[model samples]
Target: MSMSALRRGRKAVVALTTALAVTLVSCSAGEEGAGMGEQQGTPPSTDFFGYQTNSRLVTTNAGTAFGAATNAELLASRLYPAAFVPGPGGQLIPNSDLVTTQEITEPSPDAPRKILYTISDQARFSDGEDVTCEDFLLAYKAGKMRELFGSQKPLANEISNLQCAAGFKQFVVTFNPGQGERWRYLFGPGTVMPSHAIAQKAGLTQEELVGALYAEDPYQLQEVARLWRYGFSVTEFDPDLQLSYGPFVIDRVGPDGEVILKANEDYFGDAPALEQLVVWPRSADTQRLVEDGALQVLDSSTANPTWYDRDSETNPFTLQSQPGDLTDTLVLSGYGLFSQQWARQAFAACVDQGRLAQVSSEKSGTEVAPAYVHVLRHSDPLIPRLDPVTNPHKKTDMELAGQLAGQTIRIGYLGPDERLAAMVQAIKESCEAAGVTVEDVAAEHMSQIHLEIDPETGLPTIDAFLGPVDPMYEYGGPEALIQNVSALRVAEEKLWEDLYDIPVSAQPRTFILDRSVENVVPYTGLSGIGWNMDRWNINEELAGQVTATSEETSEQ
Candidate 1:
């Protein structure tokens, strides 16, 4: 179906749903899909259904987690922390539920920059503990310069100090000797770890945890860092240790790897309308499940549908899609032969990014464009390109990479990804011709390739891997501060290599949602679909129908 025709069809769905009142769905295992009662056609169940990506909902390892720590966790974190949450329009805003006042001062010669984050006395977690200044301090220290995990990401790094008033609600952040962008945005949507909970888990007093951050005591710091880095893992999620301050708290991690969040009745802010929010993984065909009403939001990224295949008219909902902020690229791990700048540049030049984008667009029926640099959002004036872009795919550079003949560069990718596979194959064929042997290491999933390794080798069985070339870290976010990442380079054994990203295509997040659901906002943040889930509402009667079905399903 044509794009315009599909959009017009959505008009009809909007009209039909105008009368439905706000409603939501619930889950308790064995009672999920039966939410529509005995309706022949799956009537809009009150449940507000959405989707999740690869089962990695909590791992911090970039290779296996798909960056979920920064993305998916935002949904749960938004409830407790009031500093920042992704707004409906893609900008960061203070969560009114927790934040009472947010002040951003203009930069000047005398006092360059400043941000004040003040949470409400009413702010509290699911367990009824008050949200305090110490929580934000924990996030700032643990994440700012990677003092804990021994990695260097410039997030939450700029503040010279965080001074809090006696009550601990009003916190003032003072800048260091120089102003930093990561410092600018960190306060915009700052993430806070539960200081009280972390202290309890680490067997330290609340005073000790905050004191450790202030004193930078190696002994106490290491204890806090251990939990921040590895404690909240979804693989071995400990509900008690992973307490939440959000509107919904994680009740359990399902056997199938779904993160199940139950309503946090003790929450300080307005309770979320939905009692049970289940972020489920797509088990089989996504489009079919969405068509059957088993899924409410069909993420285009996971569905991997092309433009021509993007149809919303025949369905009962409006397809709301906006450009995603991610770019497709081949990130060459600068390990072994790829460590040299010449070697990295030579192989990067040979891969036909334009051709790769074209092939992908044709396969997915979407328009694809080639990216020349890391940061491509025309919206941000930051990171102005200094060089002109030209294609090497049009002309071969066999002579350039000929220096590394007979060198085997192992390239790994998520197996069965048709689009990625195509890009990798093109890269493989091009690199191989230049005398550099390209070993394509395909894995069933990201964990298989990234987390697992041969013991004897002591190296990632592969030399290089392919994934999104994060432009933000370079000039996008904190990495923009300066390339002073030698500290980070030393932490990771294999990931230390200079990253060489060859931009392939610009892929956007697309979604098809039921008309019965409201406030469907498209966001370009880490929490892709759930960027504005807090504002999502459903139809009242439909929710009742879903509840009845659930009760019935539970009985059987």
Candidate 2:
């Protein structure tokens, strides 16, 4: 999905408005025909669904957890429906499944970019409490203070006062100067804590309550920061404490490391498609469960040909892929002998990106695009141009790299994983051709390498540093590359003017799924295959056909 399509509140309103007049029709025939039905077309049972991952959701910290735990939170975000939800095409579409309507009116282009939003009268929390303007204000205030669930501290810096009118149906929020572009990030996804309840429980004065929720005072700021770090561990949900407003409530955590969520029939929107959602820690053995018919959906990361092509007659298996927002890059540190522009450029020019991508695909089971920009946004300049076939800028001279000999270049790398290691080895060989001896260093020990250059001589203590580069694709746009390069430039003030470590390609998260799964939606930054949890469903008839074939073979 494109980043522009993921803005939760505004983009959703825009997409639904445009889609209102159109109807989507499915062309599939046979048992895969559209509309939910059994045998003759009945909606699948809304009792249980199966999903598998390769890690555990141990931390509730949204900013820190980047693996399985983060995926779990995303899954929960769908079940515990937020006020706004991302749509199928990656547009933030209303969870008409939860919220009825959320309308926003902004001033004309001639006026300031401020906006006013009005909530639907039918909106209510899962607890049956009317979702008033105050609720939004409270949510915004908590989010801005970074006291709400899943809040990012950097996002809290953009919002201003969020005030609800006395009638409770109208509310207004203003943004800080220069934050107009960042409004979406500020109010994206997070839990809405009950403001009245929290204030009453804390027994604070109105002034103090405002301060705590808005963090106007240093004490309140510190307290909210503490809660932001450690709030989930507080047992028991009090009205003042954070409580989920989604379709499911956290029932009990399992000793076997499973999280059980039961449907909240009182949910304000349409009841969830499932009665229960049991999330288990991700495991490598998850494929066994699918083979045994216990799991209906498994991420492509874990699906091998053996399981993917499991006999439908007996195993009833299907396959599919979920696209994600992961990017892998080859980063060069500015500290080493590589601090020289000629040295870095020479190295970047010699490495063959096409071969590197081929090796990466073989090892990572993902299609490695040669460009540095993500495949989805082909126009974004973040992706570097590196194909020897298409790139006219590729270095054609090997003798040029020979001048940097005797200067040892250190390259940092993630691991001995397939794509990265292969790329590193290829670069090492290429450097050898140029007469430069390259040393591979662990990425963890990057800080210890002090290869500052001598300003007078314009030569580094060490030659160069190369490794895996982790860039923030979610927050920064095309300028992300420039900013990354600029930071290196600023730190190593005397280094060459040219950017070190030209980005070769983005290592994106790829999901492979059974083709039978319909309307599968994948989110960005999602690694592994289970990113689309609720959307996965099976075509039982196709499964049965596969099963039958397997049974006949077993009898023989």
Candidate 3:
């Protein structure tokens, strides 16, 4: 089912359970001033509110909600540093938090390329654990299993006999044969999990610690995998398991789906502007919450359609819309009818892109653009553009579509809702205009579509798949995009080439705060306030603004 529909269904189930007078309470953040002691009017040190999913943490499979959500919260923080960090200008900068300096000491005279990363003395974990060469060895070993083998196993297939060892306060990683050049791309941006703590808990020998990760025994490895999955839980996440070298830490998760976060006092760098952060899940009625003085910051995703109506004098909060990097695209399978570039181009030309955008704007209040490319201002400059207007098959003319009639094409899409339905209907209409017989197949679970390609044909049996692209990690530059595209082209079978995947708009994965919150830095694509719970605080001025606005709206 569509995630939105599933959420709606779950909401109904929760409501039914609630109607039975069942108190559904999970993790509760205790009374504010009780356990932590009294604050002397300088404002409570920890404060923020938000929401969380059912699961706290899970395996980092990239596909699972647990992996995607938790990793976004945990790893992106300064505490768990990656080799490269996203700078202010949305580029991957050097790892300033952990490494003082990095220099490529030796250039390879042979086909293999090599670079050296020198460590600094200043780096330390939150628990005063020195960031050492051993830690890097442990991290690489763990990552090889968890990231490369466990979830993104395809990555490991490209390389042969990857080796690493601790050397004089530095860890040297070398890839075998022709794989050396790809080491930087493979090893960078991975979170270095605490090796000493994890290894000690696992109770394995040093040799076993390094070699057991790549064990051929499936049964033995499954047991070891469980350890990595629940490693944080074993420590009770004490001292805040969501500890960070970053600016924040998870504070509390509430039963009512509210999450609260406070600032990390030990943050290494310049502190953030906002102090407290809160994020409420989709459970609460956002418009009602905004009007009831419960929420301050809102996004285009969560904002109700009614909230954008300028004619509504009863609305208290001002709504601002900005273009984002998210895009909704109609992707075609390279096999079947879509195999021909002209066939795909013909469909694109017939569909009224402007009309589809208008319907989307009406339904969701999100702006839409009429380009095949997903990210805004990021057209493939390498490719020359063709005029859609001048094309013979272009236009919403139904007579033109009749020429391609009787061709059976199945298209898959998410949601049966009005917006998506309108898009589907438009596509069907356009196809019929081109004399094509299109079948609208219901793809309730969009993720499953990724796995549904035929093994023998290597083509997506379904003609098309439509959905939004949430570009979680920013591709730093055109070169990065080129590299990624090239990798996918090399990896993907010939039948999946030239498939459509576009990012249309950008959305800030921000922590929603009550008006009282202050001094929080919003991370893009990371949801939930507790993702960075340590840096949250309550601000009376912001609280008063929410209260006053709610009161005025309620009276109206």
The candidate scoring highest on TM-score is: 1
> What's the C-alpha lDDT at position 89 in model 1?
66
Q: Model 1, clash count? A: 15
Kindly indicate the candidate among 1 and 2 with the higher TM-score. Answer: 1
Clashes (backbone N, CA, C under 3 Å), per candidate, total 15, 39, 52
Q: What lDDT score is found at residue 439 in candidate 3?
A: 75
Candidate 3 residue runs with Cα over 4 Å from true position: 1-82, 100-115, 118-163, 166-169, 172-207, 214-220, 224-244, 265-267, 270-276, 302-318, 327-359, 371-556
Q: Each prediction's Cα lDDT score?
A: 0.53, 0.44, 0.43
Q: Give candidate 3's TM-score.
A: 0.58
List, residue by residue over 344-375, the lDDT tens digit for candidate 1.
Answer: 76666566666766766655545656555443
| lDDT score of residue 478 within candidate 2 | 20
Candidate 3 lDDT by residue in tens digits, 155-234: 23333343444223464455443433334333333345555455555575445555655454445445445544444431
- Which ranges of candidate 2 are over 4 A from the true structure? 1-48, 60-73, 80-84, 96-111, 119-161, 164-170, 176-186, 190-209, 233-242, 302-315, 321-359, 371-473, 476-553
